[model samples]
Target: MLYFIAPFIGWFVSGIIKFIINYIRFGEEAKKRIGNGGFPSTHTTIMTTTTLLIGLAEGFLSPIFGLAVAVTYIIIIDATGLRMHVGKHAYILNRLERTNKGETTEALRESMGHTKVEILGGLILGTILAFTLNIIFKV
Candidate 1:
């Protein structure tokens, strides 16, 4: 029960912190909202936090650890690579649409994923957070 709950706690806390940071840095009037891509990646935060906790609870060198690492790697790669590319493509498409129609359409922005630096930052932050919580709770 506690094991199941830890990840949620970590994710919630990380998300709140991220949101606050975004609000502070970008200001309340910024076009972007909280959880926008800039700093620590929430995707990385939640996934890495959960996996690290699982790994630590199970065993650092166990199969679970390997699986967790693989999952984390894939997520981070997607967030930084494929997602970013798709965002850029969307921007170009949206611009083309606007130019052709001579009016701006209500289109969603697809550039919501993190950069490599942001992913790395999230990885480091998540790892530290998970490790710290594990130690503090002696879980």
Candidate 2:
């Protein structure tokens, strides 16, 4: 139950935070955050929460806990590395398209990765939520 609940809670909480932050900062453009890329990385939050919950429930030395940690590490690396670079490419493409094509086409998405600060925010949120949920659920 903790496994199922942890990921859901992580996604919901991180998404709400991201939405609110983007709404405040980007006005109507905040809708874009619903999909990906924001102040709090939803992927990181979900993976971190899930991994920590597993560690708490299964013991940190357990095989499943180790697997969870590996999965979480992969997610973090993808968010900060590959996806970040993809987002940069998207930005450059959007710029080129705008310069050459004018407003005829939609812009490529430029927010597809988490910055260091955003990842840190997710880590903090995930950690807090994991401990809180663990205490409440006694798992």
Candidate 3:
């Protein structure tokens, strides 16, 4: 296997970088919000990073690359599609709860998925990191 380090590193560093940027744009609360489903979905960063690394390490036409592509597709789909519903639902429920009763200490987690823009950001970050690593190490 290739070092497989790029994906993990990219996953984390990209998120942190975006989080910092968000903080700059929106203040401290942005730091907290950036940790989850925001622009540059962390999940997509990791998955696309892995997929690209696999493609680079193995021949793009190889079965390993194919498998990685398949898995990555599913993961990105989940991040952008299925989980978005959950986030929206959480927001709705949270609003409904607040409407019926006063504010509650507990609130649903709503950052479960990525929007198209967020996923696109992830794709870009992953592409940059994975290719940069691949070029540097030539693995």
Model 1 deviation from the true structure expressed as Cα RMSD, one decimal place: 2.3
Model 1 poorest 10 in a row by lDDT: 29-38
**How do the residues 1-139 of candidate 1 rate in per-residue lDDT, one tens digit apiece?**
6567766766677677676777787777344655446567877877788788888889988898899889888988888888788778878888788779577677657656787778877788788878887898787
Write model 2 residue lDDT over 1-139, tens digit each, in one string: 7788889999999999999998999899788657778888999899888888888888999999999889888998999999989999999988888779455577778888889999999998999899999999999
Q: Residue 82 error for model 1, in Å? A: 1.4
Stretches off by above 4 angstroms in model 3 are: none
**What residue runs in model 1 are displaced by over 4 Å at the alpha carbon?**
29-32, 102-104
Leading candidate by TM-score: 2
Among residues 3 or more apart in sequence or in different chains, the pairs in candidate 1 whose N, CA or C atoms overlap within 3 Å are none
- For model 2, the superposed segments whose C-alpha errors exceed 4 Å read 101-103
Which has the higher lDDT value, candidate number 2 or candidate number 3? 2
Give lDDT tens digits, candidate 3, residues 1-139: 4455766787777778778877887897785675568777777788778788888877899998898888878988898888999999999998888887565767788988888898898888888888887887887
Model 1's number of clashes is: 0
Task: Give Cα distance to truth, residue 37, candidate 1, Å.
Answer: 3.0
Instruction: Note the Cα lDDT for every prediction shown.
Output: 0.76, 0.88, 0.81
